[model samples]
Target: MNRETLVLPVLAGLLTSALAGCGGSDDSGPGGGTIVVGTTDRIEATADAPAPLDPAQAYDTASWAVMHNAFQTLMRLPRAGSQPVPDAAESCGFQDNHSEQYRCTLRRGLTFADGRELTSRDVKFSLDRVRRIAHRGGPATLLSSIDKVETPNEREVVIHLSAPDATFPSKLTTPAAAILDSHDYDPKALRKGFEVAGSGPYTVRTEVDGDRLTKAVFTRNDAYRGELEPRSDTVEMRFFDDSAALERALADGEVDVANREFSAEQIDKLEAGRVAGVRVTESPGQAIRYLAFNTKAPAVREKAVRQAIARLVDRQALVRDVYKRTGDPLYSLVPTGIAAHTNSFHNTYGEPSVAGARDVLRDAGVRTPVKLTLTYTTDHYGPATAKEFTALRDQLNASGLFTARTQGVRWTRFRQDAADGEYAVYGMGWFLDFPDPDNYIAPFIGKDNFLNSPYRNRAIEDDLLPRTRQKAQRALAAPEFRRIQDLVAEDVPVLPLWQQKQYVVAREDITGTEYALDSSAMLQLWELGRGAEG
Candidate 1:
């Protein structure tokens, strides 16, 4: 079938008439009753802390919370599943049997919020700009497979890959692949300021900005052409400095929904009915927290030193005391419930043993009481971080094999410094962009990986990954993933600490808590709603 004939009918089913009456109740009209959502993550645009509104540069979860709603990609994750279906594109698939060339046909009459045309050229431009700018610690790494993009026409886009990659389409579903108007964005650099031109479910009407954003106002984008119909006409996003402030907002009924950075104590209080009218929903999260080791650092360049330190960590104690058992002890880079997840750390290290740690250190001819510096962000990862890192330090010191000193920096500076390898050891977290084993493995082990800590495993990166990508069925590729995990455990570049349980607290009147969290563990603001009480 020809591209136009195949896609036009699908487009008709995907989009509602632009002239059709807004689907929700009249009271929920654009900018009417706002759905206030609270989070501990900050939003800023400065030389030190850049705002995450720009799709080309923003990669962290804080920015993705807003970007996912404001920007539309060719494909989008459904409200429930990990697999992505077409959002802007009417149809998308590999053109050849080898999966070397992937193509998508755009839906007809797509336009940005400004009414500018959004065509295949814009899609090519957006992906190309990501590669060109290639911001350090940015999402550009996600597009490493694509060699070039070819826009055959206004509606058809062809992506030629450097090698066969089945995960390329999944990569397009990420915020990094957000289609942008060529007319609105500069082709060479990241756009400055908070202003955005997107074709997503909502558009930014106004923003209350500072080093930390007080409020961000988003109204329904009438130009949006996608399957996700907004339940609430307007969304008001509020930023808090800590979980205490967020809990206070929830109790005072100032916010309808609260997500990200909530502490274990707060979750306990909410579940115990400490908050009279609020409800808490919890789900298994793909997010994994870990400790990254900078191999180049003299203090830990020795494999024995790294493995000895790994042996000193007690995952159960950390999860129970620090996270209050709200999360699970993780032993591999890939979290549990995903394909080929193995407890490689537990298998290798066995348990936290002061004797074993000392033996490893002593056998390696390393001096006792090795001085090591551990770093983490005080503001970004929530209040539990201080307690968690302190526990880690205590474990190491108690082992008598090491003397550890802990340092904390604010997130903005911490991110930049971490990428620059300023700390020998530091804490980091990963929230998946897509729910695949490859999403968990490739980004951390790739040539230019997410960890900014220089780690190269040729067996996993060049050989295993390419081989795994060739398998059409992800389940069939389990053995390779298992091998990758085993290598990661042995290398000890990063030690998987724990896997989190996703939680979102909202008022009793609010509905759709179940649908609010997408497969990526990101809350969909559009899915939340307030009943008559709202």
Candidate 2:
């Protein structure tokens, strides 16, 4: 279908809502204090860091948390909303009727932390470098649709796409699309250093007290020309080894605000007012946990086997028994709050049934006691993962139709082995890059997806996604997204497990916990501050 006939009307209608959603209000707080944010996430030097802070090279959530404050993208998401608004760019929209050409105009008087003029050329260079370097497991895959970049002048940048993608603007809101100073970074390779240069709300300075990174200090950027205004003059982010250490720091007054890594027990205690001086804030999280099946594996390659295994999964049991009802039972890749969410898995598999599962295996001429190996990470996901896997094994073994063996691997090695197709079935979790339903679907099922599994559906990759992208209003694409969810349920490549609930704990003196979480579930450093007494 031609882009003009299919995509232009929707694009036109979307711009108004996009503009309205992009507006952000300044946060209200007592202000004038150094906010110390504590997290269990490790921030290491190049020698021990999981990934560098370079915008083109960093893809993990930990790195993005710091990079989001240090660097600026052409479009930025507001602290309270998901819609992309102009950041470094004064304004942006489709320049052609086809919706394949997008243009952005640089804001006047924008400069990087290094005092270099920020222009369209830097925007073009930043995008081109991500695709050129294409680091493994990096977010360059987010920009795979861009055919080329055109600079009409110093102020305007035009991005030409090979296909129409309504979600392209949302991609630019990610840290991967962060614009860099052309004069500071070499275009040929990834930037080599702990420091970064960009036009954002804050400029970061890294401190290493020992072998590990001790702290990251973020000072308000005077040159920033964006919608967000820093409530605190400076933010000091400290990294801890685990949730216990992080919680202790908050109780001991070592840290003012704590970001994530709280166990369910700790959360319950804090919620019940057991903690002396801390309060917990809860929000609907965009993260999901699932089980991925390697289609190339001999035992799981059979469609009937996968379907039978799907029937054996009890999401309610997993949530109640394992998660302690801390999260909601998820039945599709698209979480509940998002548009086009359906209970496809429940519709397809019904409740957990031993007889039905056994019949499915018998119909396929498979023997009883089917052997399946389940792999998961012990250190990364949480302490609950081990118990979760154990529960899964007990559930499957109780049916007498399958014998499940569990294996534990560290996160880094597990990710590599999963990509290599070394395991038959594995546990995985997804944190959203953007709040759109497309973010939930495209990244897991699209070509060369993050899963690295061999499963592929031509209808999902080629037809449904492209057609959905043609719609200007995201809600209008509900039918297509629902249909895609049904297809995923039928295929059984990845089974939706559960969706997380976000919990942020802060001291009584700390304000702005209500606005701390952005649309992507990342903490907004600019929203936090201290009370008058603090």
Candidate 3:
């Protein structure tokens, strides 16, 4: 749901509690040695979050990467498709045509790592806990549609939604719906640090220095029983400051694999066989970066102002100069390689032209030199982010239709200020919550978006999104999504910027680097093993 997928960025706060009793590290487990994974994403534990590993608080990509192995959801996104298949539950589907009431039956004899029996009661408790402790940055918002959970028996769990949502199964695949042991986690608070108790394939322990989580070590969960047949018995995730540091670890044989936050220059070197033992694995990415407007801000209150900026800006030049041609200019809210993606923005704005932009402002009777401040975070999306905003400032200012200035803030303060509407235009990145197309559409267009922008369209919010959610067959909803993208392009609530390619760097001895990043953009560490080079 946030940038943590590829670059969820940094979150910080004082620790409210000192937690975690250390667990043993497994040197020799299933696929043999400890497979260390490195990344630039740091652990963002806060007052409400006692541990970076807790499903209730692990919303960022850093935590979510490891959480996939430590926790099990009732349903999970499959290896190749957007549809979710059963994991903890034996089977799950809608019980009614309206897509409001859903049911799941747990697999028989499922037990936590500590040997506690898992049941429908535990499932009910885990889900209800999310509602009770609604952390602002947590993934709990993914389950906001759920009205209630009922456990009629030890195996049967039923969920009633406040409205129709066929995409609910995909939401269950996220960390928000992770099924935790009823005894281990508090019903109304977060279970902090690295202590983990779940029926997934792995059990976790951690090494931390104050608020900084140095590393997390995971071992096979022997008491587990589920469908996911993990290939590795042991894995370790190392947190680094940036991709440069992570690449050094990969080059020095300190870490088995490197994920996310690679610079365009570094990626080019790897592509040209400049990096010795390590090879780069690139896939069409599901991540996107865009500009969101404060709809009520004085500078961009009118529709023409936002459209004019969109017309004058050239996505191609921005990608070539700022991203070093490592990115594809995105023309739609939904990214390329995803089903239902369309060139809605491209169709509306056409090519970059100063004359078209000037006419837009003149016809609207707007005053010349529309004043606006472009706000962004310098520390989050690599060093290129500031340059990206700087490029935007130059483009808008040069057009002479707007007076644009750029503001750079650190990640912590940037998110707060964006939420507070302190900036007229906000720059943010998105990683998919689920592999489905709705993940790209739903979060950005609603009344209460993650962007904190007030953008609710009567036709979209009331009719289109609901109809799209009602379709059990996700592919059948493409028409609705197309219309949604068209409306969003016309409205210009948020501007589509660029889409990036997913990259993974691994040593020649590593295997299964291709499978590390799953369909939903979450890491599957269990896929890593000692074998031939990827």
Candidate 4:
């Protein structure tokens, strides 16, 4: 219920996870059995864009989970914490006291799935493609700190940043920074098709139906040369439309692990030991969900309209009744327990007041009964979405200043719709790209947000962010961070909703479930295998 239990201590965690090697296992032994994992998260594709497995185009959790396992990065999160460690790189760190420049030296004899050598050129090419293609709704925004990449030799990569960014190393661990084969990928566009190659612990064989990635079979890469040693032979990952199907698959022995998108009721049952033969593992949940407005859309483009909606929302009721108290009500983009967090929204609009919304609308000369459309994904977050939207609609209608309607679509279409700016207001969730407050505030308000929103604040993009990045101590950036949150509250580009915990359920015979997840919310599939008890 509190923020302390949800986020780890910042400086202390970095030190502990850096020096402590006890949280991980050294299971390099061969495994003959296959493991099946199920989740409601799906990799979306369209006829216009057939790029599913390309790391440059992947910005979602489902895609990140798949690509991170199949592709190695220069830096990776430790098993127990959010700080970065060398993965494909033999040794990596910043050179300056201000954290401006970063360097990495690749491990020798690294090869791709097809036995192609991986070198510093591949790392430079992978990062360059992210900026070159720059697909709408892609993870390219994470690379805003980098000025350019340099390869001094075949084994060394040097990066120069536009500004000092201490969090720059953590950004390299995302799917966006996935070290790719320079020969296999397109430099100008997203590589077409479901097939992809990598040099990580596993090599993936994908199955696509229409536009959805139905299943991906990951076989341990015998040619891989990285920091991790594979514990299992193969992993079969399946995607479902909803949590109900995921639950049934887990119970019917169709899946050896159920990873994400469980309904509140099912989670409660699992916690109470109602579901037999399953062991649950929990992580300090840093993921936050909120509503993002396409600032180019009509009606929603008005600042007063957005601020009014913020005043009318009752986060308490939404969390208690709709979510079954599974999440805490979030009032800021930077969730509670994260550094520089403040309840700016809650402070500005104390308790949902109809009068408060009406006064704001009237003062702005906005006509009464302003029409609004609220969009949500049917299959993305969980089953409680419709109820949440309905609750929101009712809350807005009761204010008598707006007429709100709701629409639901599958994530495959909904994601495209939001990026195209086809919706006035839409609901979206952000699992962390890294464990920094900058990750929360920066990604949502930029000019070319992955959502394709046109909201841009020069003060936030240029002034506040650079000031915060200059300091080594993250807590020292609180003054600029507080100003950034204040500006967000005033602009009202995104309205914060709630922060929820993460859960992974596996069979009792599964080994290494406790060390299966890193602080970045990525699943370490290499840590999983059948236990001797099985």
- Candidate 4 lDDT over residue span 268-384, tens digit each: 888788777776655446677788898778878789999999999999999898888778898898888688899989888888988999898889989989998899888667788
Q: Could you list the CA RMSD of all candidates, in the order they appear?
A: 6.9, 6.9, 4.9, 5.4
Expressed as tens digits, the lDDT of each residue in 310-384 for candidate 3 is: 898789998999888878899998989888999999999999989999999999999999888999887677768
lDDT of each: 0.76, 0.74, 0.76, 0.77
Assess every candidate by TM-score.
Answer: 0.93, 0.91, 0.92, 0.91
Clashing pairs in 2: none
lDDT (0-100) at residue 479 of candidate 4? Answer: 92
Poorest lDDT segment (10 consecutive residues) of candidate 1: 1-10
For residue 12, give model 3's deviation from the true position in Å.
21
lDDT of 1 by residue, 408-482 (tens): 997668777877888899887777777778877877786687766688899998899888888768788899998
- Model 2 residue runs over 4 Å out of place are 1-30, 43-50, 208-214, 532-534
Name the lDDT value of residue 75 in candidate 3: 92
lDDT of 4: 0.77
How does residue 507 of candidate 4 score in lDDT?
74
Task: List clash counts for every candidate, in order.
Answer: 0, 0, 8, 0
Task: Give stretches of model 3 more than 4 Å off.
Answer: 3-27, 47-52, 192-195, 532-534
